[model samples]
Target: MITAPITLSQALDRVARERPQAQAFVAPGERHDWRAMREQSQRIARALHAAGVRHGDHVGVLLGNSGVWVQIFYACAMLGAVTVPVNTRFKTEELEFCLKQSNVKVLLTADIFLGIDFLELLTQVEPALASAGGLPGERLPCLRQVVVLGERCPAGAQAWDAFLAAGDAVDDAQLQACIEAVAPDDVLLIQYTSGTTSFPKGVMLTHANMLTNAWAVAQRIGVSADDRYFSIRPYFHVAGTTLSILVSLMTGCCLLTLPKFDVADALQMLDAERCTLTSGNDTIFLMLMGHPDFDRSRIHLRGGWAAAGPQVMQKIRDVMGVPGMCNAYGQSEASPNITLSSFDDPFSLRAAGWALPHPGMQVRIVDPGTGSPVPVGEAGEIQARGWSVMKGYYNMPEATARALGADGWLSTGDLGEMDADGRMRMVGRLKDMFRVGGENVAPAEVEEVLHAHPAVRMAQVVGVPDARLGEVPAAFVLLKDGQDSTAAELTAWCKSRCANYKVPRYVAVVDSFENIGMTGSSKVQKNKLRAHAVALFGLEQPA
Candidate 1:
């Protein structure tokens, strides 16, 4: 049974008391038990406090999926500090924006990643930080300290190990007492949105919010201690941290963490670890299916978690070796998950699963034109209300008011349908739908047919203005490494599978997509693609 406070540190203490020797996390050659995790968390908590971190203070984490990240997260929970995990993929300018916006006082990062010197990036951004109004004499004013995670600490940074060693062994009783003081409603983490439109908005989540979502997901998926979880999603994402780490911790399951996502490496890890549960976006699933050694019989589980088109789900199960897979629909504002398919519901494997145990969470499909609830089974805007909803966007009251209604429902900005069983079938984004010759066209429906093509690797659809039709659907396609297809050929292929009006009138083939940082979960930055499409094919004139 869950208890009050709902703090991560409290949960870890419970697990330590119940199952001290259980393997909590497994990395390359390192392993940690519940007892060790608790101890490390305490030590890190003492170090953070000694560094002057206080309740409600924001600490930034810019490291990868090392055990240290987990320790830092739990340590913050113990110290009542809020953690702001920045994506390591961010450029110097992007990092500067988040650092300033979050008002971060301390930064924990590695010296390098994939051979790129992060210290060099920090140096380049130092002047920008000063221009942004950092304090005098401090390289980064709001940033009081920098802890390096890797082999050697850079000249201006402190060593992570040295800081941990500087603190005395924390008293277990005192640590437990501190955990008891945290409230379930206290802001625990701030997950920045992908910022498809403009700058990212920080999604403020509380202990109760995340705990409820994780518990609901575990119940819906039937995850137990017997489940061996393997994940490549960056821990900075809510899916990796809340679902993978918190859920695993609560259920006493074994967690296998991969530093990064590589198709071959992911396949090998799943096989070696005998991973029974995994989750990812459509692109990652497609990449895994293309790997040579992907086989269902090796590590088949109840079902994997995903969020994509139904056709993509089917292909993953039939073509890849994964038979049991499910789709979940959510956003960062809702702690990342609101709906999930049951393992027994075979039909849901093809749809974006049913709403989970957040029975208090209300779902409504409203007509895009009138903002009225649509009839059952008809596609409309998906909105939600309940405990899972975030408190509000950090420091953006106007935007927050617009997103969350006075009655407390969140406008998800997604188009989907609720079936007879209350299951959700996501059609596309509301902004992605366009009208052509007075008929509504959903780009996702069109993209699904295009993805069925043998040579197609991925596809994105948008509407470009046309002189005759007002707006017409256009497709941006990516092909397999050595495969090729002409615009006419792909258009003809889609014509055979979809309505003529829904078929893309203009097609552009590209080798890869532009990098747009994702939210905690791996949802695409659709706004970026929309802008790119406008530039590539002039929105003012038809091709």
Candidate 2:
């Protein structure tokens, strides 16, 4: 096996040298081979250097999933500059917060995507973009340059063509010096957390932290140069940048993606490209397999990884025909994966919702309250210590101190149990777990029972306030198309399968959580669901 690259730029160089003609990226209307990818990234790196971005500087990328996004990331890596991927779904306030908090110097963005005018949004945040040289504003003092990657470039921003042309004068020797100076320990990505409960914190991940984790994930899933990977993960999140993009690059596979996820479009691409590997959470898999256009025979899926429960894993293998699909668990701070089931593992073991920690990564479940190790088979907060842990949260010392301990263990804030066989089974997030009177209740256990029902397609459980019991499970469910089920019936279904306290006291059938509770990374935001449930049921809000 090839040794892992110390830096992302080195990874790109190695892949280009080894497989110059191999396909590296494919999106709608665009494609790049390994050699072309590296060259384009180097050109962009020169342009960025010409624009006054230097080592240790933060460059914010606000674009959709496209080749430009990948090029910008590699360009930043080549210069030892950190890439801060702003969520495309960000509103005015969110965009402003990310820019100011990260101290971004150069901003690369699309003019408009999905009908959201980012240039207009930036103007709203600073209001200076309306005039000449709009940047270097009072609101965003560090921001000096704005490069727009579309037809309409505002007065303060340079067009994509102009930005690339600026690099023509930069000599190869100067660019090579910058690339040579980049080390494994330099900060590569500042991935902001999803901010489910609070404001997002920028997780500072070094080149070594991300590249090493991607190499490990690729090995576990048995990825190779012959495979084509279809991933629906948004590029702004760590799941997209590290697991999907980096994994595909390291293995010399084509990374296929869509700017915006459409069920029909995704299905068509899978069949057209004959994609071999794919990755997603339960919701994405449900949408794909549950779609009216789903036909497993045409799509040549071999294997991939899923951050899902047993129900979803089983369906992906049996119904979706991805037998090599493995169960996975992690958060953004651990470069996104702490445990993953190997591709060659038996279906029974893979479907059991247990994931083995990657080699060199140490995982220990400890009591959330006491920090004491829990016995095997007992559930507790999962803590991981290894090279994969992020350096720290950028500019948030208190948050960093809370997340990373002095001894090197990074507290994941997730709960799980380790079996005697050393495989870990995720119970639920500690914040997501609620107490019913006195007994602890995991929402996943109840959701699993709900998933077993024939009519249910997807479900999310949250605790709502109760005067007598202190808290009780309230479930939001989406039913299968052409099927019918009521809230009372589903609650009764769960009552029969789950313990008394584990059963949801109420169930609300919803058509979708896309607008209400889903995050950019496709995770169900339970805090939002919990708030919605409290308001929907007229229950007293938790203090």
Count of backbone clashes, every candidate in sequence: 2, 0
RMSD of each: 3.1, 1.2
Which candidate has the highest lDDT of all?
A: 2
Per residue, candidate 1 scores C-alpha lDDT tens digits across 165-220 of 76565566755566677888898899887666677888899988887788777766
| TM-score of each predicted structure versus truth | 0.91, 0.98
What are the per-residue Cα lDDT tens digits for candidate 2 across 225-245?
999999989999999999999
RMSD of 2: 1.2
Tell me the deviation in Å of residue 92 in model 1.
2.5
Model 1, poorest ten-residue lDDT window? 128-137
Q: How far off is residue 214 in model 1, in Å?
A: 0.7
